[model samples]
Target: METEDEAVQLPFVGSFDRRDGADALADKIIRTLSFDLQDFRRGQRPGAPKGFAYLRERVEAAGIFVLLIGNLGSHHSALNVELFRGFALADPVAPFVVINDQDSDTAWSFTLLHELAHIFLGQTGVSGSKAGTPVEIFCNDVAGRVLLPAAELARQYDLRDAPQAEVISRIAAIAANRQVSNSMVAYKLFREGLISHEMWAAVTSLYRQQWLQNRNAARVKENDRGPSYYVVRRHRLGDRLLKLSRRMLTEGALSPSKAAAILGVKPSNVYALTETAA
Candidate 1:
C-alpha cells in the first residue's frame, strides 16, 4: 500500500470488460506496449521485443510492478510447488504481479504473462497451472496467444501423427525457443484445435513429471551454495521500488527506518541494498 501512494497513476488501457475474446485483448495489449512480445529475443531495430528484461521494464514503465519471489522449496517450505504458480492484484492505480522465481525460466515467463492477463482484466487472484476456472482459462488463453500466436504455432508446430518421442522433442524445442513451458505449448495446440484433449493431457502430464524431477534436483543443488543475499533482496524488492527508496532517502523525504521497512531490509542493510541495486 505504501507503494501505491508512491506510484504515479496511469490509465488502464485494457478492453476486456465482460468480453470472451482473449486473443483480441492480448493483441490490443501488445499494440499498447508497442512491440511483439513473442519475439522475445533481443533485437537490433527499435521497438523490437527484448526478452524478459525488456518485458519487465515495459510493464513497470506502464505503472505496474512485476516482482519475482521465492517458491515453495525455498520460501513456502511446506506447500506443494504445483499449487502456487503466481499471484495478481488489480488496482487502477497500483496493479502488481508476482511470479515464483524458483520455477524454471519457461514456467516463469508463462506465469508472468498469465498474471499480467489478470491485471489487464482488473481481477485479483492466485493461481496454479491446473486451475480450470473460467477466469483462469481466459487468462491462460490471453497469455498463450501473446506468446504463441495461432498462425505461427501452426506453421512451426504440427504435432499430428508424430511419434511420441518426436512429439516430445518438438514440444521441448518449441518451449525453449518460445520461452514458454511444454504445458503452455500443449495447451496452445489444444486451444488451436491442432491437438486433441488426450494429446494435451498426456503432454502436460509428462512435462509436470519432468518438472518435479528437475525441481528436486535443483533444490538439492541450489541449496548447496544458494544465491547471493544482495541479489535475492534486490530481486524481491524490484528495481523501481529500490530506486524510489533511494531517491526518497536522498531527498530526506523518507527516514532510514521507513526506507528499510519499505524495502524489507534492516536499516543498515538498506544503504547496502540500494547501492547494490544501483
Candidate 2:
C-alpha cells in the first residue's frame, strides 16, 4: 500500500463513534458490532505460537507488515529483554508491527495486540513492560480486553476476592484458555474491579518470578538442543515478507544481499528463509 488510505480498513474499527477518550474508545472497539474473536484458533502447541500465528495473519491481512527480532547473543544486553517488548510504527505509507521474538510466544499474544492497539489509534511509539503512560495503558487495556473479555471472564470465573490459592487457580485457567500470561489476566481482573490492586500486584509479581525461572530452564535446554537456523529465520521474517522476497528474487528486482538486509539474515540464508514461510 502506498498510503494509509490505500490500506484495507479493519472491519472492527469502522464502528468507532469517536465520542470517548482513549480508554473508553478501547472498550468501544472491543464491543464493536462486528467484533468477534471466535476465529482466534485454539491449538495444542506447547507454546503460544498457534494463537500468535492466527492473530498475526489477521493483522497482516489488514495491510500491516509484522516483523520479529531476537536478543542478539551478546547484544542481548543492549535490547534488555526485561525492559523492551516490542514497538509499532503507524506510518502513513508502511505501518509496521515489530515484536521481539525472544519474548515468550504466550507473551507475544498480548504484545502483538498491544501494538495493534497503537496502530488503530494512529499512535506511533515504543512499548515496554512498564505501562505507566496513558497511551501504554490504553494499548494494554485493548490487548487484555481482546484476549480475555471482561464479560467472558466474569461469566466464566468467580473473580471475587478469594484465598490466594483460588485466585491463582482462576488466573491459570484463564491464561491457558486465552493464550496470554497470568500477569495479563491479573491486569484484566484489576481493570474490571473484580480484584483489589494489592491482589493484582501479588499475582503479577508471583508470575513474573515464575516466568523468569521457567525461561532460564528453557534457555539451558535450547542451548543444548541448538535451534534450527532456517526455522528461526522463517518465523522471524513471517509469511508476507518471505513471499514478497521470494517473488522479487525470482523477478530479479531484488538482489540477494538486499533480501538479506530486509529479512535480517545473511545472503546465503535468504534463499532458505524465503523457501518456506511456515
lDDT of 2 by residue, 53-76 (tens): 777776666656788875664434
Clashes of each: 0, 0
Ten contiguous residues with the weakest lDDT in model 2: 10-19
**TM of each candidate vs. truth:** 0.84, 0.82
Please estimate how well model 1 matches the true structure, expressed as its whole-model Cα lDDT. 0.71
Give lDDT: candidate 2, residue 40: 65
Q: Cα deviation in Å at residue 56, candidate 1?
A: 1.3
- In the order shown, the candidates' Cα RMSDs to the true structure are 4.0, 4.0
